[model samples]
Target: MLRSIATFLCLRCQPVTALPLNLRSRATHSVAENQQTVEALYDLSVDIQKVRKLKGWVLLQSPAYTKEVAELLKNMGASGPIIAHILTSHPEAVLCNPEQIYTQKELWISVCPNQRELVGIIEKFPASFFTSSSHHDNQRNNISYFQSLNLNKRVITKLMASAPQSFSRPVEHNELMVHTLQQAYQELGGEEANMKIWLQKLLSQNPFVLLKPPEVLKENFLFLRDKGFSTPQLLHLLSRLKGFVTELNPDSMRRTLLYSQDTIGCSETELRDIILRCPALLYYPESTLAERFEGLLSAGISMCQITETPTVLELTTQIVNYRIQRLKARGYDIRTGSLEVLNGTKKDFEMSFGKLQLRRERPLFNPVAPLKADD
Candidate 1:
């Protein structure tokens, strides 16, 4: 494809007088510029065909100053293959003119301590680095606003790389969301000194929360409140959820709660207790809850046992089945016993399974031990 495009550009480079006037008017970009872009990309070892497949019109329709982009990256300490990978991964980046890219670099430099770190960020998140010029002021204002809040440069840099949309919007947009979070923290009796730490942790856990509307957060709070969660309980839930509370809608939460109650045969009070133990019960949709519930039942795991250890539902049905099979092979009856052994991460499960194996292999009656004591 690159060769074909280059050949076509060569054909178009013929003297304008050699072609009809109608054809001469059709050349949007000078053939010289198009040929140069392609040659630069090839020189840099970029997969030109991949870029064309990802964004076909990049070279023909847009003024892709790929050589300037490579030069800027090289100045930032990027190596040859890293630049090629960035271009291959996000071909649209070449559409950015040098001026816009320089502006973006200055904005990022305000948060990044040095060029090396900026290159690392670009290498990892190319799309985030090549933002549109239209977002320049908004990105600048948001960075300053976060700095005013005393957020470290590293955290601000992370926000840019991980969730650039949050920084691209107007500063007022983030202000409203931050204010809502602050108010919620204060209402929950959070200490003023700890509020910043809490806010930082929440944002680090899920930066995308900044992209959601403030009203969604408020509505989720109201829904949890109506479900009998006090303000302190709501704060606890938010902390346990790692600030992903905003991801849940009232309708989904309600559905999950109802399904949990029906499957576990638990009252609203009991359901609340289970949700406090495993917030996934409140976050997962009905379909997920249903699949887990059916798997537990099929494995002869009683609903009562499930209620006792609601965290077990966090594992998918397949994982549950596999773990159950392993335990059964070792003669551990999951149905007759508690579900506590299967309620944790992989390391936790291994440790618990090892203990069960030891228990199963221990001698029930050691008659020879009494003879030794007598001797």
Candidate 2:
């Protein structure tokens, strides 16, 4: 078993199709009659030893169809190195029967525009394509259901590639979650025309939302409502979170809220206003928020400045320290300046820094002005 491990080192240079015609025909032989599954792996440059270690029981229980898997991938337009990499990365892919994989291909093709695109997805996410055959019915049903909803094909394809588990479960599971989201949107005053668009964007942003029990979403909504957030405000937060609201539970959210209010020395109304401006404060853990608060305070930033520019809290301690140092080096005192300059992604910070540098280096007086007489 260990000896076969040495063979995969050169697999990068060789393709399964490079095997001689006589050896290639053996792929059609029965698993029992053909004991060359290990040899097939070696020929394809797969790490047999690694596969044996990770999923040895698979080889012990039943023969792996490495050649068939390679053939299937080749027919789908995968290059030699891609095929080798996929098989190497996911050895259990060979355990799936050729017929099941064909059916999966057809199902994916129903949504994918062409084999080239499907091949690219398979290269990146081989497990999604080689999942258990038992989920075929559920996968088919869920694909049809999403299509019925008029969701764009690209979004459906993305969900299949990134979150196959969502499609493997019973169709009813997704239906319940979708219904909950729809009802919440309606209550939040979402219009009918925008319903499908909102749902599409939400699922595209976080397909795993479908895996959560519908009750979790309801409980979160109630918790936020109890915290004095109106329906429109809730919608704003949900949109801002990019549909990750399902990732939060009331306990964690309450803890984060308490930590924010206590550290900032803000009343409930003030904290609520801060949360509306920077929704992440409601989800970031106490440790993270505490570290950021300590960094800003130690830098001579006042609580009033922090409260006024809560978005700065989104930056990590290291980032805040680095940005403060950069601004200080440019003669800009963050202690006296608005903390708003620190509120944005990496690109935004670079733009702000560039503008600050220009202002500092710029000439205060006209260099070309006529010199006054010594008098």
Each candidate's lDDT (Cα)? 0.85, 0.84
The Cα error of candidate 1 at residue 4, in Å, is: 23
104-208, model 2: which lDDT tens digit per residue?
999999999999999899989989999999999999999999999999999999999999999999999999999989998888888889999999999999989
Clashes of 1: 0
Top-lDDT candidate index = 1
Best by TM-score: 2
Cα error of candidate 1 at position 252, Å: 2.0
TM-score each candidate: 0.81, 0.83
Q: For model 1, what is the error of residue 193's alpha carbon versus the real structure, in angstroms, after optimal superposition?
A: 2.5
Candidate 1 per-residue lDDT over residues 16-35, each given as its tens digit: 22335354222323453366
